[model samples]
Target: MLTVQPLQPATFPVPGQFYMLQAGASYDPLLKRPFSYLSAENGSITFLYRIRGKGTRAIAALREKETISLIGPLGNAYPVPSGEFIAVAGGIGIASLFSLFGAATGRATLFWGGRTAGELLMTETVRGLVRTAVITTDDGSAGRKSLVTEPFREYLAVNAHLPVYVCGSTPMMKAVAALCSDAGARCFVSLEAYMACGVGACLGCVVKIRDSENHEGRFRSVCKDGPVFDASTVVWEGQ
Candidate 1:
């Protein structure tokens, strides 16, 4: 959890844009990584990210008194749920569901999968926002000792009418998408990509697809156009 400090408030998340967070002065790469907002209260925004490298380690190691820079509340939020909602997440994917749960009024079913019970941070975070079940790979933990999508599929089998949202590793997303689609369930996905720039100026995060909007081309920016897309709309080429 991030604490408010000698605040440096900035307003720059363009509904679907991102911010570059320069955690500290120790940036060996001379810059910070980009992050999407999970949720924001008052003026604070939440980011869901994993520790992977020196820079990431640097920020993760900071104590409560130490503060880092936050650059946004960016990116297009997923469409507000129109009906019963169910969300399936893997690893840190639960972050994507934060916004969804915030806007939902009906009972929400959430299935979060992590490597271990200790990693299910978002599970507890959503307690007040919605109903959640955490699943861990380690059998000794809490919920089922299966992949996050396993429980998702099981819920889909019985509650086929609920609208489903998913975010996680690409392979996991694809696997669940296929199963959900076959079962005739409507699904949405929030995607992840390696980004250098958080805005649309960089054409680095492009996804190939058959343009249905105008049929002009077959390319779209993941960072700009979406980090989220309907399961049926995404042209998961090469998958």
Candidate 2:
């Protein structure tokens, strides 16, 4: 976890938006990595990231007051739906949900999961924010000893009127989308893609979208068109 004071507060990032953060000061790790704005307050923004690679390891080694370059609040953000809101997150994907949960306030319910209890990051803050919180760990180390989708399925089975927002692995999001489709509930998914450039110029991260008018699928940049998209609008079969 890291919090940074932006050079300017006028353009702070909103939930679901990301910034390109360079891991180190050296040119060895040339490209900047994209990280979602975890939470923002008092003119500072927080980021949640695990040390999975060189880029992340570099980010982990930083000390206080260290300067790093950033590109900024890039990509589309999640829309605030009306009525009930359900949020689902897997592993480190929880990075994008804090602000959303805060915004939704009493209207939002969060279902978060990880491989084990220890992996469920920011448990205290998450529990304190949402109206309802459901935690799951695959190894039974905390909360329920089942997939978060299990509780999610149980919830949606009864409350088919609510909308769901998810951020996680592609397969997990796809599965949730399928569940929402069967229940006729609205769903939005934030995708994680390997992006070379935070902007759209690289054309590195793309997903196939289902076009209703053409009845065909078209490719769109995840970094530009969206990291957040309506589940029904995504073409999961071919991807």
Candidate 2 least-lDDT 10 residues:
98-107
Off by over 4 Å in 1: 4-18, 63-67, 132-134, 138-140, 213-217
Residue-level lDDT tens digits of model 2 in 1-239: 98888775548777788989885668867788889989878888889998888888887888998876788889988897655689999988888877887666446788898889878888998888777889999999999999889999999999878889999888889889999999999999998899989789989998888777754668889999989999999989645
Q: List the residue pairs that clash in candidate 1.
A: 15-75, 15-76, 16-75, 16-76, 17-75
Model 2 residue 47 lDDT? 91
Give the C-alpha miss distance for residue 85 in model 1, angstroms.
0.6
Candidate 2 Cα errors over 4 Å, as ranges: 8-10, 237-239
Q: Please, what are the lDDT tens digits per residue for candidate 1 over residues 15-101?
A: 233455767666575655766556666766667677888767777777876778654554566776766788887777776676677
Give the CA lDDT, 0 to 100, for residue 213 in model 2: 73
Clashes of 1: 5
Which candidate wins on lDDT? Answer: 2
